[model samples]
Target: MAIIFEEKQNIFHLQANDTSYVMQIIRDGYLSHLYWGRKINQYNHSNKLQFVDRAFSGNPYPSIDRTFSLDTLPQEYPGYGNTDYRNPAYQLQLDNGTTVTDLRYKSHVIYKGKPALEGLPAVYAEDKNEAETLEITLEDQIADISVLLTYTVYEQRNVITRTAKIINTGSASVDLKRALSVNIDFRDADFDFLHLPGAWGRERHIERQPLRSGIQSVESRRGASSHQHNPFVALLRKGTNEDNGEVFGLNLVYSGNFLAQAEVDQFNNTRVSLGINPFDFNWKLNPGESFQCPEAVMVYSHEGLGGMSRTFHDLYRTRLCRGTFRDKERPILINNWEATYFDFNADKIEQIAKAGKELGIELFVLDDGWFGKRDDDTSSLGDWFVDKGKLPSGLEDLVNRVRNMDMEFGLWFEPEMISVNSDLYRKHPDWCLHVPNRTRSESRNQLVLDFSRKDVCDEMIKMVSDILASCPITYVKWDMNRHMTEIGSAILPPDQQRETAHRYMLGLYRVMDEITAAFPHVLFESCSGGGGRFDPGILYYMPQTWTSDNTDAISRLKIQYGTSLVYPISSMGSHVSDIPNHQVHRYTSLDIRGDAAMSGNLGYELDLSKLTEKEKEVVKKQVSTYKEIRKLIQFGDFYRLISPFENNEAAWAFINKDKDEAIVFYFRLLSEANSPFESFKVKGLDPLKSYKVENTNDIYGGDELEFVGLSVPTELNGDFQSHVWRLKALK
Candidate 1:
């Protein structure tokens, strides 16, 4: 294992055998650096840094670019003036005795005991166990100025893990509020940035209906502040109080300007905040405290998300994958949420499994309503016992029956939730999260379990783990229905109410960590109402996430786009839902729906038994084609050729390594009648190479294909038309 570091540039590279990863302290770079363009040094300010130009300047441009100043100082506490008193001026101790002063503008500063290099530290150990831990420390001198940047490398599969810390070494206590933001740059031509209405609420955009524009920002003074401005951008704030304790929580701020009311006793002098956004998870750190976050692991590929997710899975394959599998390829698994709603049982599930097998499905997941007398949302949550009435014989028998049909079996469980009518809730009413004497709220007839309590977490863990131990279940769909409200914990005293959320999340992580450690072969999919808890933190434990409940292809175009900005497609749980849609009542072509869903894990949530013969044949061919190119699709380089948000038509492409092969899926969402040629030009290809075109109307060489981008036919003749083109470069 070799780790390379470039001290002058503050850049670090890690290489383990054949795999390589890069990390840079991007103090002055913008979020746009990830995709829009390359960075080029045009003017050299000093030997330490340079003024660079951004290659791409479309969407996601950085807010600012400035020189980074370096300084050396003697150890001191709150040195000098009032505001600048905390800023430390240190000597770099260069070989030459000439001391350099005021290297950069000093912002808020603190004392760092020793000097650490900016680049990756070389690892002398040959094994994972022997690998030395690398630490890089820098004091942020600029007060109130947040260091924001995006980290990416040319090659895919280059796992980049980064963690930041604000060490409070000053004598006078300082209040620190910070955020970590990640902007994903895989903008395909078909990407559409969706804008939602209502503050902390959900809304969709319609083409023909009234475009409800110009809505004022409304602030909700509920338990926490929430505002919903645009669908893509969401801000949630977690804060601390005066005495240095945890306050606020994972508050979902949609689009509001209201400040959170501070509870007098709830204030803490030292704390950290957890911010959950659509793109990245941000955290706030205080003095003497350290927050460890999951690193952003990247996998480079010539393939797409399907390929990338498989690559990610391969990282922990030893502990996850199991059973007699067909080929190393992932099974074309189909879930039943969008297919048959909450109306499924043992016989119904077996029928779906049989039909799925006919469609070449490798796994059959019986989602929801499988246990605890959970026929409806109104009853039996928190109760983990298998409902013998639902399964009849037992869960093991159902799993074995599914396995007997030459398919893997998976089940869904909401271990963190309990219904008021549930046996568990009836037995321990105090276990659910709620304020005494207050009306307990319910979403989907469920309330969150008080995982902050050790007993609650332990019992839930045992219930879930025991089931996995008793059955040969290959997959577990872990779902959390709603965000927390009425934030109170029975285990904590009044002063520790603010600690409830953090403790709850920590407890959840603990249980998951133990479960994964014990049943290393079982794959778990983390889902929160569908993409709410989708963050790198959760991804560290679960390989994939349920992308969203909105299965409408048009809606998914935006949801998946925003999601892909920070997360890889491999971790996205996309499925072919009903055409008329289950969540959002939007009608999308089945072919387009399948193509869009295939971009992710490539599964179906709709009932295969209900499909028409033609639809079934199309699905069969789709499954066949997916198997042939699934690797490329799953592990390829993702480029956002065109954003569906910007254009009426949606277009995106995936290119394999060597740039030898590529596939572009274009959708003419809303047709324009009497348009000239009804086609659009594509981008991001080698203009010099000649290429063969597959599955397209026009055959062109690489030169022509590069110079004269393919012409995708318009859907003016019909709604929801699509074009699938395969290109092979001739070197």
Candidate 2:
């Protein structure tokens, strides 16, 4: 059984494959967290909450017991303004203007399968026996409000997902000041806080620090899970590394404004909370209406950060991402964004596609400026029709030109944006999100569409659908270039003005769900500038995301490495672009670039026709090699050997699930004079099996390769150099 309820002790223990989460109903029916870590046969109730008489710790039941205070208990979903001064998991304001809520255990139900979150993206169980869910109801009698906390545990993965539903069971409406998804308390604050923080182009860089006395957090208030901070955080025990110790990771499956925080109290206990950012946010729950927060995924790993990452990779790659392309090997495509940008004609696009087909590329993507007289970024965003001047033969003619070359075709669309110069904008001036009489700020000469309005979403769906249905487009690069500004929905009421951001997210999801469902054969890749909206929410509709706009090989070493902490390799759209690279203007070797991009879904963003004959040969070889190993790279278990953040070198490997094949990639950013000899050690290999190294007569036991490690080539010299090794078991 994945979940066990000890009735007498009132303890609820949820067990994943190798981890466990235990909580119990304590004094006065308060739900408190007990333990979360390595799995055990049974929780002995040894980690019980301690009742103490502390000064200034307000107690609701002071007359019954002065020592029993909610302030000291390690609560599962803590309430605000009821003595616990730490940040709350949720908050509510009654019609009488009091911001106090006391939630006590009411009832609970355990089920075999996990239920889906209404209108939200979440990890799901395909089979009933694959997971179990426990829904516990906590209610405040005075406010007539009930908070239902849901926990789902995967039977074979070290993952547990949490969500909360706030229901107003009274006649009066209540304002939800804060409705965070999940919260947990730890007994001590001796852990290191780890998060991914970076700016645009250089996204998801790893940052770690020791937990201080105050609150430390990573959040995105830019109306997106912005490139500034990813919606994920982890607590690592002291001395933990990639392959050892313990870690607790929490990732929010949301793309809008969010917050992930860890607060260390004076007593040294740590409280971790994750959910929607309460900044400029509130939800009005009317009678019989309930609001569901986005799901928060929690992963516990005793085998270190690598184990935690692998658990996330496996779960997300299979369960979280859905579509025709989810399990399939991604195509080797060439995107013409960098090759042609906004300066391409139909003939120029075909020339690049022709060069790509000759070099073994399987797909050709025609990027921005193909539609609606859009010669540059300043105009024609929402008008999805083809520009007659650029594509005189129409979009179908261009798609057919590429399809006739035995290669698939794809197109790029900034569906969530509108230019002031667009015909669509001229037709419906109120389509863009803005307050009346306010200056609508524009980024890249585009304004965000008011997706909170269903009419606007329906029009977008129709426009995009018409194009997809009119051609043989097999892939789409759905791009959103800017963040929200002047975020007000004209259709919403004054009381719900703050609901614009979240409502827009919901509308975007609805559009994606409808469009993707209509065209199941199409492979959709999400982008926000690049990697700006790269969160689990978008991954649910689109299998992969353009990892970043910065394709510099040396730069990607850190970007991709940090991204792998939570996202799977299959979910990252990595491509090799020309150098002096477009984003950073740093020159790196083509071989090095190919090596970096090959670690994920391999593609190219450079003009294939511009490469010399020798470079063409190298590109051909890279394509062939990726095809040979793409299955393993996409579906294998990944391990991080060295980090680019901490070392001058970065090393990672992928081993198939059957343990018969493995691939290792080692990179050196800059060469050293007279450097010490090094061997790249790898994990997840079968020790007893003998394997043959590809391209060599070398045969060795897996034990020898894993323990003794592989020797790094001494002749490798220069900045931004890399090496790859392939191993196949000698059956």
Candidate 3:
């Protein structure tokens, strides 16, 4: 069993693969966090957890002398307004307006299976033996609020998924102001904070800094898990690296506005919390009403950042993400966005598709501008029907033509957005999210649909569903171009205005659920102007995310690397686009772009028809090579050979599940005058076997290569140069 209860000590020992999390329900009815780290044979922290009265911090139970002071002790689920100053895990506002909750342990149940959140996306237990979940119910009688904290421990993944269910059990109503899904208090803050922060074009840049004494967090208030900040944060010991050291990581499985924070209190205790952002969020829970928070996946690694990352990769890749496309090999697709932008019509699209088909591309996707007089980003976002003017025969004919060319077809849609000049908007202007008197701020010449309203979401879902059902569309690239601005919903009352952002996300998720469920055979790829919505929440619906808007090989190194810190490479939608790169306008070798793109679900975003015979040959070779190694790149264990953050050249290795094959990609970003041939050791190799490099006749023992290292091509010397080395082992 993954979860074990020692009733005598009131300690619950939750084991997830190589890690163990211990917590205790104390004599005073407080559930205190005991320990979370590498597995131990037994837990003996109950005696050491005695709490004392602190000078400034107040206690929760004054009558229970010094058994445990909520102010000083670590907790499993710390509530707000009980005098504990650290950022709270849960908070409630009563009808009389007292925003206090004194929650105590009520009861708990341990089960073999994990329960699904009411209406949210979460990681599930694929098999009963894979994990066990424990539900700890805490309540405050006077406030009549009960918070159910659930912990699911994966036996082989070293991961713990946490969530909370807040219910108003009394006759009176209460407003939930800050109901974070997960929080864990560490005894000390002896770690560094690692986060991904960047702007629109450069999303998910790895940023690591020392944990200061105050609060350090990554959040998004733009009504999304914004491009500026991702919903992932990690704390590792000072010297932790990709391969070594203890690291604790948390990722919120939510796509909307969220907050992931770690606050080191004066006492040096660090409390890490994650969930829907409380900034512009509030939920009113009437009697018998409950609010289910999104799940927070927590992973603990004694083997360093890579271990932590792989744990997440394993769990999320198989359990968290659902759909027919989850583990299957994705199509080698060519999208027309970068190839033709918004100028493409049926003829232009067919030209590109024919070229891609000749080069063995499996799919051709008609990107933006195929619908509703959409020549540019300025108008016609919500109109899902094909533009008869562009495709004279309509979408069905184009889809059939692509299929006849032996290629699958995909289309893009920005269903969450509406143009001010669009027919949908002209008829129902108020349907767009806005305040009666506030200026309706527009982004990309479009307004965000008030998805928080069920009517609006239903319409969009119907439109999207109808379009997908109309044709044999194999994939969908669902894009949300803008973020919330007005912070108001036309159908929401004044007091419920704060609920707009999260409710909008909820509605958006509902639409996704409806569409994805209905189209079980279709593959969905979530995109928010590229990678803005690349989060676990969206990953639940769409297995892969467009890693970034910038497909430049040089820029993608950093973006994909940082994204890999939390997401598996398979989940990244990386493509080889034309040069000078679309976003950066920096010319890169076509082969180098292919090498970088091969690290993800490889595809192309260039005009294949424009390629010279030589360039076409190179792309053909790239596609064939990708097909040869796609299995290794997609499902194999990933190891970071070198970080782009600290080097002029980047390197990484992908080893197959059986350790029989390994592919190493080396990218040279700069030319150095006297730099010796780059040589580096590798990982995840069987020491006893002899492996042969495919390109060269060189053969070496696995240990010799993994320890002494594989050498780069010393003869190659140029900026933006790259080489792919695949090793086949002989038993």
Q: Please, what is the TM-score per model?
A: 0.66, 0.99, 0.98
Candidate number with the higher TM-score (1 or 3): 3
Give the winner by TM-score: 1 or 2: 2
Clash-forming residue pairs, model 2: none
* lDDT string, candidate 1, 1-731, tens digits: 23445557544454432244334445442111112111222212222323344232211223553221111111111112211212221111112322222112122221212121122111011233423234444343433222212222212232322233334333333332222212221211121112232311132221111112111122222221122222122111122111121111111211111221111111111111112121111223333444322122333322332333334343323222222221144456878766665677778888888888898878888887777887778888887878888788888888888899989988788888899988888899999888878988887788889887989989988999898999898888898876667878877766456556555666776787778668777767877667655554555567677777777787777666545544555667778877678676778778889888877778888888988989888888888888877766665655555557677777777777567788888777776667677454444456666667775445566556545667765443677767788888765
In lDDT terms, how accurate is model 2? 0.93
Ranking of all predicted structures according to TM-score, beginning with the best and ending with the worst: 2, 3, 1
lDDT of 1: 0.52
> Which stretches of model 2 miss by more than 4 angstroms?
none
- Lowest summed lDDT across 10 adjacent residues in model 1 is found at 262-271
Candidate 1 regions with alpha-carbon error over 4 angstroms = 1-329, 683-688, 695-699, 714-716
lDDT of each: 0.52, 0.93, 0.88
Relative to the true structure, candidate 1 reaches a TM of 0.66
Model 2 vs. true fold: TM: 0.99
